[model samples]
Target: MSAQLPEITFDEYLNEQLINSLNLQTNVIQNLAQYSRHISFQLVDIKNDVEILANRVIALHQQQQSQFLPPLQMFVQPSIPPSNSLCFFPPAMQVFPPLHKPFFSTTPDLPNKPVPFSFSTIEP
Candidate 1:
């Protein structure tokens, strides 16, 4: 059997907490969404801080890239890679050989014949 639940006492602070608790949550979603009154304010502060940090990082990245890297040359062509570059292959090379003309069974093709065995071979 279910136990009887205790009644909640009315309080000025509790009423204000309940009211603000509902505001801290969003109702657009069907499922319950809730956050502490403190967390709500902290999240706003964090969002502002993140925006400021993102702006500073972007500005610093731009400044650093401009200062440390060479300027773009419109007529420059990238140096061609040396012709003697060596390449490596994985071990699956055991099962496969590079470009050998694929040959199937060595046996030549034969034309089809009718059924070789008959059921009338044995007597009843």
Candidate 2:
């Protein structure tokens, strides 16, 4: 013999559905609150990073400016390098080898010579 299930009333079914929906909404609200807190923490970290970077940039700029005055003298007399003697480029007094003519001449009247690549004079 088959056993029959008890029938639930319409009002009882509606109350059950409402309770389930309220539970779901409560869980969603709790999850949303947790996410908001996490985002707030991340924002705080980003703000701190930005502040630290700004301070470092300011310090570096000040250091560069303090040392810039010595280099101003080099402009007047290019023969004298900066106080540190670390030149950024070839000194004005250094002579560069003359640029060699290209092997292929556009004009027939000009003869071209092959130039060898040399770095004998440049110090490492």
Where is model 2 more than 4 Å wrong at Cα? 70-124
lDDT of 1 at 83: 68
TM-score of 1: 0.31
**Candidate 1 weakest lDDT stretch, 10 residues:** 109-118
By TM-score, the best candidate is 2
What TM-score goes with each of the models? 0.31, 0.53
Give a tens-digit lDDT track for model 2, residues 22-83: 99999999999999999999988887776666556545544544555442232323555557
* Native-referenced Cα lDDT, model 1: 0.50
Across residues 1-124, which tens digit of lDDT does each residue of candidate 1 receive?
A: 9999877667866997988888666453323333465678898788777666755654554454456456333343344455675653333432433232213344232223222222234367
| Superposition error at 70 for model 1 (Å) | 3.4
State the weakest 10-residue window (summed lDDT) of model 2. Answer: 109-118
